[model samples]
Target chain A: MKLLTLNFLTCAIKTCKTNSASFPLHPRDAELEIVEADVNLPFLKNILPRLMWDELRGICTELGLPELPATPPTPADLIQPSSSTPETTDAAPIAEADEEPSQTAKDLHRVLLETCIQEGKLVCGACEHEYAVKEGVANFLLPGHLV
Target chain B: MPNPSTPAQTYETNHVHTVYEEIASHFSSTRYKPWPIVQTFLQTQPQGSIGADIGCGNGKYLRDKSQVWMVGCDRSTNLAKIASKNEPHSVIVADTLALPHPNGVFDFAICIAVIHHLSTAARRVEAVKCVLDLLRRPCSSSSSSTSIFTSSATPSGPGGGGGDDEGGKALIYVWALEQKDSRRGWDEGHEQDVMVPWVLKQKKEKQEKGRRKKGGDEEVGAEETKQEGDKTFLRYYHLYRKGELESDIEQAGGVVLESGYEKDNWWAIARLR
Candidate 1:
């Protein structure tokens, strides 16, 4: 499962739904793999504001990846500054298409879309219930008792 | 055989989940065509909108929109494995009533042809509530993040978003009881609970070998022998009567925005009330 998915997932237990600690399930002994995918800059920009930055940063830190910037990047920060001349400013309609993705966008895409957990267990902080991830598919099916 | 007294989960595990697991590949091969109503719903979501496909068998709808991010979940692990292959979308093994998603966060959700498998009325209503709970709650203040997308101007269809404050919408589909014109010919008075059989034919090579082992003289009992090689699994379904789906949504604290019958199934698009 991608780290992006972890943002939305919580402990499946009904009782844990009210617990603040259930959201952002923590990864344990995760075997990470990079599965390359084309970067969709517009999508990254659109999803940027919705991302829970602090939780994602904590997850990255837990996984021992490099620390992210203290704050989330704005949509403008994700795009490279247009290098076109003043003559091209008149072609405003097509200018948006010409805007290139910056290095931050690529890194963001790499973390959110490309990096996948091949095998691991996501431990719910509230109940300490572990959901196993195998072959990049996280099993969120709770046992009968948990359900 | 599960009786009326059997637990809904246990009954579904035997009659629904197991059947799908055993026939995942064959079932997925036959279910690639997206229904027009469902196709339109997925296509109209704003770019980069996040959604969930509950009980997404083989993830056919997941491929409908590349601009939106969708995460699919299924009770059957085999089906989830098949659905996980859809790029840019993830699939996890999860029960509908116990979905792992946090409450009130998704932009949209679709539970296509899945709710009918729950053997009880309460469980079915719970399933609808579960889908609604995944949606973003209605916001009184117009947040900048949501207002930034001007794509809402796209032509609104039957269940498309028309109001900004009405949270996320969920499209749910189920087999209708009033499908007299369909191949099954089931109508209003027919038994709503029925076991539908899926026959998986034995491979020709296997059949041929079995015949050869029986030594060509067993013609009298050939039909019985052939039946032995072929497997038939019965899956349980509770066909929805007209207005039942809408009622369930209402009972689950959802408001049905639009509903219609399509190709023997009743579907309704709903948002949390």
Candidate 2:
């Protein structure tokens, strides 16, 4: 299997292990932030409430950080998204008469987040096989023994 | 990503924009008019410049321009396929929510008709932020793709409602835009009806009824109301007002060059800061 098969796995394992063992306490930053989701997905900023406390905390812990508080903020608290939202969309056709009756700003916010993140998914752009971005980075390089 | 309609899905790609493009083009010529925006840029875009079309449905804006290296990204793959078939100007298939390109590579970028329909606040705002991120550069950048469009500089093009200056020149901004929408009419004889969004029968009937109610014979305004063949698609559009547009651009680190609204449409030009 292509180590590329474990691209993100490689990144996560690499991150979990230390560089030269001398910098064990150094913060494990994931490779250049995953830019594939919504390249345009904005950073969670001042005005919106916090989103995805658990997932974000998990991501932080995966990179060796303290977990987040159990209670997370909401749009009312203006937490900007630290991670891109998942990507999912509804393509159902809409009749013009059904137009203006849809959703609230908050509801729309959740939907947008759903569209940006590809949680637990690491797809092979070359082969379309689904892998996992377990710890943040995708390690596609499989070892010879595994292959 | 699997189709959003599938059950037990972990990921979904945007499919509406692609279908929307096809449906829009069936009646109107194009879902978005890119030539004016791109041509305006190319005539001035810098060398080795990396630019992006944020909601580049089919990458039309960057299509066929060899000089300025460009990337085209959208939130929808189906729509990107159409852009690939019809335009194919972009080098990558990536999402605008998180552009795959490295930072500060582009000197300029464009996001056309992408925000209003964003369906989410974060993605919408992020689209502009990506522009900000990409436009950031190494010291003094020297890369300014700045242009000015004054009222006098704004070409009337064909039928922009200006003096007939074409007495000496050809034309520009000649394309006409048609807004398309559908209203389902109840057919009492049938229990169910499926009307394609492409069909504008309701519009035809409404216009005909209005014409008849006015006793027909309104030749004066008919010429002005005539649908031009240049318009080739069913248009579904949402426009931002001047203030709304300015705030979004500025918040995303850009200064407006100029903005103009004509023929019930909104247009603006800006330089990324």
lDDT of 2 by residue, A1-147 (tens): 111112111111222223222111112222322222221111222112212334444444554534444665432233233254435557543322232311232333232222222225443232233333323222222222221
Q: Candidate 1 docking: what grade? A: medium
Candidates' DockQ values? 0.51, 0.02
Range of the 10 consecutive residues with the lowest summed lDDT in candidate 1 chain B? B216-225
Candidate 2 at B197: error in angstroms?
5.2
Q: Model 2, range B1-273, lDDT digits (tens) per residue?
A: 323332211111222344454443222222334445446655464333345666665455655543443445555444554554322133233444444444444445666655555443344455566555555342332432211111232221111223321111001111112212211222224222121133322234445445445331212112224353422222222334435555666776666666654332345555555
Please list the Cα RMSD from the true structure of every candidate, rounded to 1 decimal place. 6.7, 22.9
**Residue pairs in candidate 1 whose N, alpha carbon or C atoms collide under 3 angstroms:** none
Over B102-138, each residue of candidate 1 has an lDDT whose tens digit, in order, gives 8877889999999999999999999999999998887
- Stretches of candidate 2 off by over 4 Å are A1-147, B2-18, B21-37, B85-88, B120-122, B138-238, B271-273
lDDT of 1 by residue, A62-97 (tens): 998878788988877888776774565556344445
